[model samples]
Target: MPSSLSGRTVLVTGATSGIGYESARQLSERGATVLVHGRTPEEARAATDRLIAAAGADAARLRPVSADFARLEDVERLAEAVVRDHPRLHALVNNAAMAAPERHTLTEDGNEIAFQVNFLAHYLLTNLLEPALTSEPGGRVVNVSSSLHRAAAIQWNDPQRIRRYSRLAAYAQSQLALTVFAADPRVTAVSVDPGICATGLLPLYGHEGMPAAEGAAHVVHLCDPSTEIVNGAYYDRSTRVAPAAAATDDRTVKRLTKLADLLVGHTA
Candidate 1:
C-alpha cells in the first residue's frame, strides 16, 4: 500500500486503542515514523508491538511514549520529547480523548476529568510542539472533535464543570473547546468526526457503535494530500464544514488560551 505520509514523523495520542490506534497503525504501514502514545507504559509497549507486527520490519520506525493525560507535567514531558527528538513533525493527530462518563472527578491538575484529559492535555501538548510542527511545509494538526459539540456550551465561568455535571454534557464541552482551539492561526487545525466507531471504547460509555476502522477513515483522509480543504477548518467524513460561530470566536479563543496557559504554567 502507498503511504500518504511517506518520510514524515507523525505523533498520535491515545494510540494504544481504538481510532487513535488504528491511525498510527496505518501511518506506520505507509512509512511515516509513528510515535505511539498511550496513558500507561505496559500498554504503550504492547501497542508498539502491534504496530511493528502489522507493519513488519519497516514498522521499526514506531516509537512508544507513555504519558498520563490526567496530569500536566506528563503532557509537558511529551512536548519536550517531541521537540528534543523529532526535528520535523509532519503531522500531529491529536486523537486522544476521554468520555468521563461518570460523576465528577478532578485530575491532578484540579481540572475536570473530561476537560483535562480530552481537551486541555492535548491543548498544552500542541502548544509545546509548535516548533516541530512548523519546521516544514504542510505541517498539519488533525484534532478529532465530535458532532456532539453542536450541543455543548462553552462554560467560560466554570470550565471544569465543578459546580454541575452530566457525563455527556461535560464530554460535549471538551469537544467544543477543541473545535475552538483548532481555529487559532498558529497552525493548520482541522477538527473532524470519525462517526461512532464500534470498539471496546463504547462499552465504557454504554453506547453501541460502528466499526472502529471505518470510523478512522476520515482522519486517514484528512492527512492525505488530496483533502479538499487546505487551511484551518473543520471536516466530517471528508466534507469541509464550519465548526460553529462560537467555535471560531476570538474572545473565546483568547479565553481558551488563558485557561490552557494556566495549566501549562505560562502567562496567557
Candidate 2:
C-alpha cells in the first residue's frame, strides 16, 4: 500500500460498481480509510468485499454504508449516520448518480429523480457533513460531474423539466447545477469531468467509453493531498478546464443553492 492517504478518511458514494467502485478501491489501496456506499446493503457489502480483495492487508480500512438516493428521506438518514459515525472525515466523493431515465421519474421527495439524485441529495449531504469535513485541515469534496454539462441550461422556471423530458437534458442540468454548487467559497470543493468511461451509464448514450479505471484516476488525483489544484475549479480528466457559462455565474450559483436548500428542506 502507498500510505499516501494514511490517517485520512474518505467516503465514496455509488461504490457498488464502475468509476465509483474503482475510485474506492484506489483510495483504499492508497491507505485512506474508505467508506463504500451503495444503493443497498447487499451491494455495499459486495463492494466492500471487492475493495478488501484489492487492498489485501489494508482491507481493514474499507467500510460499507447504503442509501437510496432516489429518496430524500434515505439521503437524510445517510447523512445523519455519517455525521454520527465519522467525526473527522477528510474527503467526500459525491459520485453516486444514475444515467438519465427513459422517462421523467419523480423521487419520493416530489423532485425530479435526476435533479435530486445527482444534485440535491449531494447538496444536502455536503452541508450536513460540513462540520466533519471542515474540522480537519486539507478537507476536500470531489463531485464527479461530466462534460455533457456544457449543453445544459438551468431552466430555472422549469428546473425539473416537468413540461418536457429528455434523459440527456435532465442529466446535464443536474450536473451543471452540481458544478455551480461546488463554486461556494465555504467548501474545498471541485467538480470533475471523469471523461466518458465504459460504465453502465454510458449505455444510455448508446456507446462505450474508456475503461472505468481511467475514469477513476481523475477522481483519485483530486483527492490526493499533494495536488495543487485550485478549489472550486472544474477539471477534465486531470486538466482543469472551463465549465459551462452558468457554472461561473454568481447569481446562478446562489439561486441554485437556495433552491436546493428549499428542495432538501434545509435552511441557510
Off by over 4 Å in 2: 1-3, 54-57, 204-206
Write candidate 2's Cα lDDT for 1-268 as tens digits. Answer: 3328888899999999999999988888788899999998899998898776754626679889989998878878888898889988999999999877898898878889999989998998899889989997889899999888888888888887899999889998999988998897777999999988888889655586998999998899899888866777999998899888888888988899888888899986
| Candidate 1 steric clashes | 1
Give the TM-score comparing model 1 with the true structure, all chains together: 0.93
- For model 2, what is the error of residue 127's alpha carbon versus the real structure, in angstroms, after optimal superposition? 0.6
In model 1, what are the clashing residue pairs, if there are any?
Answer: 198-210
C-alpha positional error of residue 182 in candidate 2 after TM-score superposition, expressed in Å: 0.9
The number of the candidate with the highest TM-score is 2
